[model samples]
Target: MANRTAMIDVGGGFRAIYGAGVMDRMMEDHVHVDHCYGVSAGSANMVSYISGQHGRSHTFYTQYAFRKEYASFDSYIKNHNYANLDYVYGTLSNHDGENPVDYEAFEKNPTGFTVVACNADDGSTKYFDKSDVSYDNFDIMKASSAVPVACEPYVIDGVPYYDGGIADPIPVQKAIDDGYDRIVVILTRPKDTVREQKKDIGPATILKRTHPEAAEKLMNRYQTYNDEVALAKEYEKDGRVLILAPESMYGLNTLSKSFEGLERMYRAGYAAAAAIPAFLGS
Candidate 1:
């Protein structure tokens, strides 16, 4: 039987929460996702959902990952966000019953999971099947979370890896090939426009000092966003894909407020929830 898939893309910083909000509301309406495919923060989101903590995503992000104690001074200087202040570290590192996260549940759950990771040296993407990866959920997420300079590569089997967003942000085609007939995608990034202003400053600029290619990816991220956005519309014409763009979202620049406010994050799911009945023709 063909499966149903829910996909979320790579939105750096807190902007990725839009996908989480969408997933949370979908659960409330009993939308069953046979498998979830995600990159970067989206990968982390899928683990939380599979573990049944979808509703508490806000608290998880605000209180845990962004907690004052977790965000170390070194984290602020090295990686833009407090990657070291990661809440998953506590959950995955400790391996306790306090949280629903862990590799065991993800590996055994009825709903499938796939986390995307990129090899830093070769720039190759590795898709870790939930049932196949040997590491804990946190480790799997860390592999894909190598957010350029902000995130350190997840070293596994002697290879350093980073976020897959640099290459494959959304794996919609992969989900389709995996036999998912109906596809729903939540995007935290903006829809592609004909023209985007050129940015000559910031991380992309600073990064040129060492890693030029990484800097290029940062500078061209808007183009990447547009390319991914366009692909959704092309896939929708095939009769099985639904693209859910958040009605409102804070820009990626504002890290602190990206997932803030009562309606911002959940709004992504709410908009999609309202569209589902019609999409289903029920």
Candidate 2:
């Protein structure tokens, strides 16, 4: 069988069950995600999947990640000082304060996991590995999903960082190096049915007011995203990438919307992941 890795994209708050749910279905259907690489919210899902990120059987993230715990920053802030009204941290240090996703327990063993984040100051995509690093899942989670305005950036190696999707939405190259001959990517963005006009909008229009600079950078990257999407399409054409579209996906990046519609995304993920065989066989 060809080695495989799923390259999941981060869509800020829009990434509830998109990645994790897709991953679970893939495993259940025998599509087994041998390796996973994710950015932004996708990074959060990686941590959950690696830790069996559930409190009990059939919990499937519902107990913790999907509960009011992750849905709002209120409860999490009691345990973490880094939390803000918009940005949050320190929840997954351990699963229900047990089954910690530490490097000592998880390093260099079992399935592969990689988390990606961007430098807040320079807008660079940096990658972290589960097998290669001594850091815990919480550390990776902070850096991977640290969007400039929405959350506080993790001070990793003394550099401030933000969402990795700004630089590497789909880390296809990294997945290739990780020995996955077949690559699967799940995007929170639905396929565009109509061309979007490239009109300049204020930072507040594209990013939260708190992240002024990164917001400007993100708006500029919309064009850059076009390039990455083109490259992904090329991979699909060559049979190197198997893309799972967000069929009927709404709310591109907002937690409330993602939470409100968790079941929908979960079922959508199941359907999308189930189609992998057809994509591969075709």
Best by TM-score: 1
Query: Each model's RMSD to truth, in Å?
Result: 3.5, 4.7
Models 1 onward score TM values of: 0.80, 0.75
Give the C-alpha miss distance for residue 47 in model 1, angstroms.
0.9
| Candidate 1 vs. true structure, TM-score | 0.80
Error of 2 at 112 (Å): 2.5
What is the number of residue pairs that collide in model 1? 1
Best candidate per lDDT, number?
1
Model 1 misplacement above 4 A: 1-6, 69-74, 77-81, 85-87, 91-94, 97-105, 132-137, 192-220, 251-254, 277-282
- To one decimal, what is the Cα RMSD in angstroms of model 2 from the true structure? 4.7
Worst 10 residues of 1 by lDDT: 192-201
lDDT of 2 by residue, 84-161 (tens): 322233434543443345444445446677888777666666788774345533666667665554456667778877
- Measured with C-alpha atoms, the lDDT of residue 170 in candidate 2 is 69
User: Residue 8 CA error for candidate 2 (Å)?
Assistant: 3.1
